[model samples]
Structures are given as C-alpha cells and as structure tokens.
Target: MLEGTEAVLAAQLRRLLPHLDERQRRLVMGAAAGVLGRGGIRVVARAAGVVESTVSRGAGELDRGPELSGRVRAVGAGRKRLVEADPGLIPALLALVEPDQRGDPESPLRWTVKSTRNWPPS
Candidate 1:
C-alpha cells in the first residue's frame, strides 16, 4: 500500500537523521515537513518560507555536536559562497526570455506567462 505523506516524510527523515537531540529532532523534522509543505528552499523563500537564515542558524545548532545529524561540513561544497560572490547571475538568466515569444507551437520551447509570471512550462 502507498504510505501517507507524513509517514513517508517521517521515513525520509529517519534516513537522514541517525542520532539527534530532542531539539535537533524537532527542527530537522520541521525542516523536512517544510520541504513537503511547499516545494523547495527557493519556493519557501518566495513564500517568505521562514527565512533561510533561520534554517541556516538551525543547521548550525544541529551541527554543534555529532549527536545530531552528521559531522560532515561544507554541505554546499563551497558553491553557495561562489554564487553569492557573483551577483550578475540573476539578471543574465532573466535576459534570456523575449517578450514577443508566445506559447510553444508544438513541442517547441517558447516562454509564456504562467501564474502571472513569465516562466517556461515544464
């Protein structure tokens, strides 16, 4: 039988969480639920997803000892800092869309307005 979302989410959390403190357990589980509730970090962010800085802070707390989550560092592999260093990425990617481009005429890739936003349909 298919598992419910909460059950599936709990199972996923169990895999990611080995040994966790009480607070860490709550926070981490909450984070996982947050992921399921919305979409991802960016979506959560757009929804004022409780501020990534808070999540980062919680992650810091969770990383204080080996009892919660893992002791592995550099989760982003240093790419986060690198991306932050370059500020032109957002504008550059946005410039790829042309206003005149209408909906796709077959399977062709053409941008269109979706949800009042210009985004390529998936």
Candidate 2:
C-alpha cells in the first residue's frame, strides 16, 4: 500500500497513464519511483500495475538520458493505424454511411448521427 504523497502520486499516474504513450508512462513512473528512493521499484511497480523489471528498465532509461536518438518508444513499437491494418474498412464504412450518390463527397458521417448502439460489433 502507498502512503500520503505516494498515494496521491500513484493516483495521478493512474489518471495520466491512458493519455500518455508507453515510454512516457514508464518514464514518469520511473522518475516518481526514483524520488521515493529505496524500495521505490516495488512500490511503483505495484501501484502502476507493471512488472518491477519494466520500472527498472525505465529507471535505467532515465539515467541513460536519451542516448537512443531521444526516442520515447523504440521504432515500430505501437499498434499499426486502422487503415494500414484493414484496407477495406474505409470503403465499407463509406458505403454504410454515405448519404447519397455523391457518397460523402465532402465527408462521410458528416451529416449522419452515429451512436455506439448502432455500430455492429466487429
């Protein structure tokens, strides 16, 4: 369990994690854990729901100071874009939501009201 400021920091980290890229999250967690000093790895790992080794790697990266071309995440680390993953997705969506023969000349789903309830589960 965390105590006082550590708890607050952990909560803030949790809130910010989704908005951050993987490396950023790791770096932030590692830095905060560093501030906590000894036993910080275990504390931060538990709070962040990440393995201790991950936090340790982040700490190492922090100490190393962007030697790897200042890149946050390594090359080709994230999920591919939707268009790349599914070439036909745009055409299918256009066909479904196109308003007329022009077929969304300006934009697809521009005038259409879309809701989660109307979307089919993939």
For the record, the alpha-carbon RMSD of candidate 2 to the native fold, in angstroms, is 5.9
RMSD of each: 16.7, 5.9
Model 1 ranges off by over 4 Å: 1-3, 15-18, 38-122
TM-score of each: 0.24, 0.55
Tens digit of lDDT per residue, candidate 2, span 5-54? 65776698789899987788778888978988998888888878889988
Evaluated at residue 79, the lDDT of candidate 2 is 83
Q: Where does model 2 exceed 4 Å of error?
A: 1-22, 35-38, 97-99, 103-122
Q: Which has the greatest TM-score?
A: 2
Q: Using alpha carbons, what is the TM-score of model 2?
A: 0.55
Least well predicted 10-residue stretch by lDDT in candidate 1: 40-49
lDDT of 1 by residue, 45-99 (tens): 3333246554445555545644544543434553465448888876665565545
Write out the backbone clash pairs for model 1: none
Instruction: Give me the overall lDDT of model 1.
Output: 0.50
lDDT of each: 0.50, 0.79
